[model samples]
Target: MPSTLFGFTITDHKKVFAIALPMILSNIAAPMLGLVDTAIIGHLPDAIYLSAVAIGAMVVSFIYLLAVFLRMATTGYIAQSFGADNLAEQRQHFNHGLTLAIGLGIAIAIASPWIIDFSLWVVQPDAALIPYASTYIGIRLWSAPAALTILIALGVLLGRQQSGRAMWLAIITNAVNVMMDLVLIIGLDLNVAGAAWASLIADYVTALVGIYWCAKALNWTPALLKIIPDKLSQYLNVNGNIFIRSLVLQLCMATMTGYAARYGSDIVAVNAVLMQFLMLISLGLDGIAYSVEALAGAAKGQQQPERIRYWCKLTLVWSCIFAVFYSLIFWLFGAQIIGLITDLPEIINKAENYLPWIILLPLVGHWSYWFDGVYIGLSLSKGMRNTMILAAGFGFLPLWWAGMPLQNHGLWLALSGFLLMRGLFQALWLRLRWRQVV
Candidate 1:
């Protein structure tokens, strides 16, 4: 038994690390891909190319993000099923999740034009970059199904405690993306269009490999899937919860980007670069959240409620520690860090002023990130979705509206408030689980 934190003993740190290490690697690879994309695009003759890439990437992230439920819901179901010692149930979870991923992927791909149009409207792309952004987004949209399906399949593997395979898949996928980006963007001089094509090709390749591994690793069978009564219903129920959560979350993000746009192209580009850096921090910390999801869900399914509670306490403590560490890092290296990514001295100067907000973001937002794992592990999808919607409406939108007249400083204030609001709202929601536990 581990020692207590506020009357709850922490679970095995080794266990947490076992799951988190590979996930951390995978998460790191994801942001590195973005950095590479930005790096390759940033070097182009015009900065507007990077801006186009930004809008294009944001469009995909916002629209396709709804399909994320595959991984999110699958992780919880598989974890709980593993804990329950229900191998068949575990298999069923994967099948249903994969099914949902494929279905949603197809639907989104078919409706890509509509989704792209809506996203363009939301972002309100400028005339200079609109054509470039549309071209990039249009090409990338074709890969939507492949990208989303792979995410869910990988999620199932992670839930089954096969984090190693997921990590390998992520590495291979991202590596291919980087190689293709270099070939298409720079070597071939295809510009933003090339970058989008690279992602599209990489996604299909990844999806194919992921499916092969999943079949081999799980020894998947139709009979195992048959064991699940109302499999489709269960999948929809779980997926619906996650869809709502991601939709609201993406809206908040899209709106934040919109706010940055209001400050003009220079601010948008600077913020986009800063956002890439912040992503590095957030995704790295998300390793803990990923581990907690699998471990806690498994514990819950096994009726080891104590284990779930213990892991939660342990992860939260470590997250706070990492937050402080990351803040110090940002403070110490802020100038050199921003300078490394771009030649635009003005953008770097503005980013320096905004660096403090970026540093503070992770620490304040850590709670929501950690609690996301807790909720996913417990399969409390509805509650998670509801809380996000509530937070976006009450906490974020209000502050954003109020700060509109204040310009850049006011913009930073609103965005900071948004991050802080998510933390505060989710913190309150986490306490509600006390009743669920006791």
Candidate 2:
């Protein structure tokens, strides 16, 4: 059945929503951790603590996201392996991805201090906020290896259509995080340290759950760990391409945060709130992309090019419809939404100015979000890497730099421009690369 523009097609509607629901619920919960932290800190004894957590969380995000290739690369390979019905090949991809994530996580943990020091240098956080940020990043950094390991293993499960388990894991983790946040932040008054600790502990618990589920789901054995030499090389090449792609994408985010930092803590708090809002939409939309990636990769592995087009069209239609709906909701409930997540009067006021930007993000951003899934599913990492790099470097940075002289609104405009630029470049890249097909 075809998906309708404004109504459900019995079969396709159920399929798409079934794929998206767990992801959407999990995505909503994921941002609540940050939002909960921010809301709690906003009501704390001072605003500095809130700002500190915001910066420290960004540092944490930057570090772990650097190895996001583990998840993205693993998903495609696993999907392809599934499509081919090659159980041995699937097990090899899963094991290799897990191995890479753990090794990368440990390496990051060892070098965390230097990474934090560099980030602090660039951000030059307030002295009062510095200690809080340090306490948070320092402790949270150790959780990297476990977090990545879980992420990669979950990606493998997701490739095999086990998103329900992944959804449950996230739900359990978020529920734990919320309970811990209240106990640590409000009950014990640990402030930023407490929030950080809650997150770290939650990740560790979730990772354990993921490890157990992974063993049960996969054909794990001594031999699968042996790793096929040529296939391993192909996995590395694909992962490397996606690593570069995600790095450029992360840089754009880190750079934007850097720019926000230049405006002071007040603006930083405002940026923090706005970022949380943006994350909610981005992560929610990512569900569709993820489903598409799995579907498309399976199609490619089976040499069914027509299925790729069908899945792409279905994903885009549903994603765009959601984007439109999200835009309207944001436009009408902008202030109320901000009000729910924060307590500080000034930051809430400042957030009003940024609400417009958040509202328009879905319309300007949904294509790139959906396109990323299509490419990942197709294992077109080279194309993904090239497009993101070109977009971030040539498109986003240049326009952002050009608007630097305007100060306040300039930064906001630059960010919006960057989003627009990414959407445009990715759209163009897709058209060019798949000219005959698209």
Candidate 3:
């Protein structure tokens, strides 16, 4: 017989860790790749290389992250389907997600020239860095299809509780990216372009592997290709809300980077490194979020409010614990962490100055991360969308505007406020709609 604790099955903890740990490892690879990029470019003869890569990569990341709805929507739908024992619906959602991913990716690729021009215009990098940034984006934009395809595949695997497979895919992709970064950049003297090509190749390779795994997990059938309009409409609705939420968040990030650039390349370099710490922590918290998506969605499908509550309670507990752990690590090794990303004394000095914000980030930011998982798992996109809008508009913008006088310090303050308010607002919204969500 099954045992229970704290309104949860004794096995709940095992289920959560089983999904969360692999995802944490897999998600770490993402920022680890970014760190590798920074380290590679940071070593070049000039700081301009680092700045250009930072701006260029941020542009691409903003684009890809904006489309993150493709992954989030697929995960929610498939997890629900899995819980309801609707294998056919699971396969259908996967196909629909893959189709949308391919279409969106191709659209992005076709629009690259315009995107490149617009991004360059908006960022307005130093004249010396423009060519490098353009070259990197121009080459890298070609991988949009492969990158988005991998997103869809990862969503399918994760929603089905096959996180270990997703972990392998992440490992393979990051490993290839690292090896190619070394070979192409250091070995062949390709410079920033080498980094772009390395990422392009790795994305394509991972997409292929992910697609194969997805097929194996859900046997291929012609029926899978049949698109259902009602289902697609539902998918689009959820994805559309997520897109708005994500776009607002990305705008905040881009604005932060743009403001940092205005301060000078050293500030940009410092913030770039510091942002990695935030990214690392976010990814770690997101592991728990991913688990919430699966377990909570499953519970929702089964109409078990108690199970959902148990998941929320259990995951939130672990999320806070990890948040504290991250804060401690940053407090203890903050200097060494900065040193590993870049060797420039000036950049390292600036980063250490701002290290306190990074340390405070995990604590102030963890709640928003946890709420995001719960919202996604519950498929409560509208509430998520509304909270993000509130956070970004009322919470972030005014604070950021006021802090502009403080320069980078002001920027960090605004960012910290934005994160904290997102959580606060989410909590408020959840309280107001507790019955609907749970």
Best candidate (score: lDDT): 3
List the candidates' TM-scores in order. 0.86, 0.85, 0.88
lDDT of 2 by residue, 182-281 (tens): 8999999999899888888888888888877877777575455766678778888988998888888777777777677788889878887887777778
Error of 3 at 52 (Å): 5.9
Model 2 residue 29 distance off true place after TM-score fit, in angstroms = 1.8
Span of ten consecutive residues with least summed lDDT in model 3: 1-10
Compared with the true structure, what per-residue lDDT tens digits does model 1 show for residues 151-240? Answer: 877787778778888888888777788889999988999999998998898898998888777777668754554535577797788788
Ranking by TM-score: 3, 1, 2
Candidate 3's displacement at residue 16, Å, is 1.2
Pairs in steric clash, model 2: none
TM-score of 1: 0.86
Q: Please give the distance, in angstroms, between residue 93's alpha carbon in candidate 3 and its true position after superposition.
A: 1.0
Colliding pairs, model 1: none
| Candidate number with greatest TM-score | 3
Computed on alpha carbons, the lDDT of every model, listed in order, comes to: 0.79, 0.79, 0.87
Clashes of each: 0, 0, 0
- Worst lDDT window (10 residues) for model 1? 4-13
